[model samples]
Target: MNEQTKKQYTMAVLNLLQPKIASLVKEAHPVYQEDLEQELKLKMLEKMQTPFLHNIPSFFEFVSSNEKK
Candidate 1:
């Protein structure tokens, strides 16, 4: 794949991880809700250089791939 495609893939992976990561952070450090939310927002924005896909394959590809491995 091209560089842009690779970046998109990485961002897609990060986007998939955001909720789990944020939850882990919150669980580990319960007092940091505001900071964790802010950081998660920034990280999500960084991943979402393009608008996110609402369609099925684009949204679920990462999760499905993980399950297969």
Candidate 2:
């Protein structure tokens, strides 16, 4: 299969499997409720932007490479 066709097929399979996988995860991990909530909170905090941020050249370089491709 071509690259585009393979990508489409993979996305279709992931869409079909996502709900089933989520259900299984929920059933199997009924014990990590507090940990999950804490982890989610940490992720939210990490994503917050502060006013005193410095410019990172490496991050900009990575983004430029992706845009070129």
Candidate 3:
């Protein structure tokens, strides 16, 4: 995808995950929440570009006790 399209896709994905990101940022310092959310979004966007997304894990995989490295 082109840069613009990749950016649009990233924004869409960020919008879809806004609630989850908010929840994840809730524990962060109030002053840093905004920055934390932006950083998390950037990280997620980076991950979205990786081969890791090809073999995506189930949602349960994240919260499970037996996570693989």
lDDT at 47 for candidate 3? 87
**Local accuracy by lDDT, each model:** 0.71, 0.57, 0.86
> What are the per-residue Cα lDDT tens digits for candidate 2 across 1-69?
477875586567556755655555565566875565456445534543233332435788989988999
lDDT of 3 by residue, 1-69 (tens): 589987798789889999999998999999999999989988987889898775666779766836654
Return the lDDT, model 3, position 48.
Answer: 92
RMSD of 1: 10.5
Query: Can you rank all candidates by TM-score, best first?
Result: 3, 1, 2
In model 3, the runs with Cα more than 4 Å from the true position are: 1-5, 51-69
| Tens digit per residue, CA lDDT, model 1, 1-69 | 587886787778777887787776777566787787768767766755554543336548978888999
Clashes of each: 0, 0, 0
Runs in model 1 lying further than 4 Å from the true structure = 30-69
Give the Å error, residue 36, model 2: 12
Q: How accurate is candidate 3 locally (lDDT)?
A: 0.86
How does candidate 2 fare on TM-score? Answer: 0.39
